[model samples]
Target: MAEKPRLYYFNGRGRMESIRWLLAAAGVEFEEVFLETREQYLKLLEDGFLLFEQVPLVEIDGMKLTQTRAILSYLAAKYKLYGKDLKETALIDMYTDGTMDLIFLIAMLYFKPPEQREKETELVVEKAKSRYFSVFEKILKNHGQDFLVGNKFSWADIQLLEVILMVEELSATALSKFPLLQAFKARISNIPTIKKFLQPGSQRKPQPDDHYVATVKKVLLM
Candidate 1:
């Protein structure tokens, strides 16, 4: 007998968006469970086989998988969307890790208090985005129209989209400075698979839970 399919989820957190994109890209069947509050999230951990730990987890036939990038790799390879060879796989893994760096910065911006935000942001903007995005430019130039390794769809390309959307949310001008990056984002936005998933009403259950939206609004208002 065939085993039952597993449940995929994000804890109302943006960290899982890229993994969702990967699953959607490969036309996989999965459920996106978004928990609204910390209480709800914690409750989820205790209510089922899900242990108290983190969000953005996947439960397969009762097996729990954690860590965003690991989940992405599992889905990508399991679905044959990873890449053609080990070299290509290496590239996919490289950018997937890089995308996490981008995400960690965004996550920091969320809980960072206003008093020290200036100093904290300066470190991220100057040290992180400023540093890596330049390398991103050269890679796109050298690699081709595709963002990471070559001119084909890969996990790396999808990995960049949510990060782009996140950065675009934070500062459009800063995001716009990398014209190619913006253009690349737009191109990926129009990918047939993604376009289908992004359809207005087709998004079921809950929308991408922005962990930072309300927090940022508070910071700006104060």
Candidate 2:
């Protein structure tokens, strides 16, 4: 049997959380090595595991892979979640890219100064609703399908679901205006694998708190 993929990152969700979600959605079991100390991170560099001195790395298929996008694309294709053809693959990529943009904006909120955090949270929620979520709502309404791209469960759908939940964490009513998205979220979250991941005691990480923020700052020397 092939070994499970080993993930290298901090305990909290940064870029690695999406990778974790994708793997779980694919029903693949993997192990995680948390970087709790700067020494551990430096050790990875010394061992030449971090090619660019960065993580969200995966050791899989007898190869050590870095770069989050590259890792996600490889996994999506390997698990047949990418698409059936070039056109479908293109659409999946487009949708996934847009979700990443929104995810980045939400993640940055964790690093904001306390005084500015509330203001930034409101801005992030507004941008998510106006700029990103609205685009997905339109896509779902026009596609009128169970899943995005070829009406099949693909990486695009997974990415959209992940971002939808993230936005909701910031503002519970974030999806109130988008009926299609609300339905889409309900449907996708009910998938057997996804449902399991959403339950307690799963690999899924909770929203970042003060401890997570501090660990990240310490490990990265920020």
Scored by TM-score, the top model is: 2
**TM-score, model 1 to reference:** 0.75
Off by over 4 Å in 2: none
lDDT of 1 by residue, 56-172 (tens): 667754567777667777888887777789888888788778878877776666556677866776666655457767767678877667647657877787767766666655556
Q: Which stretches in model 1 have alpha-carbon errors above 4 Å? A: 1-11, 36-48, 117-123, 202-222
lDDT of each: 0.65, 0.93
User: TM-scores, in order shown?
Assistant: 0.75, 0.98
lDDT for model 2 comes to 0.93
Residue-level lDDT for 29 in candidate 2:
100
* Candidate 2 C-alpha lDDT tens digits along 93-142: 99999899889988989998989999999999999999988888888889
- Once model 1 is optimally superposed onto the true structure by TM-score, how far is the C-alpha of residue 71 displaced, in angstroms? 1.1
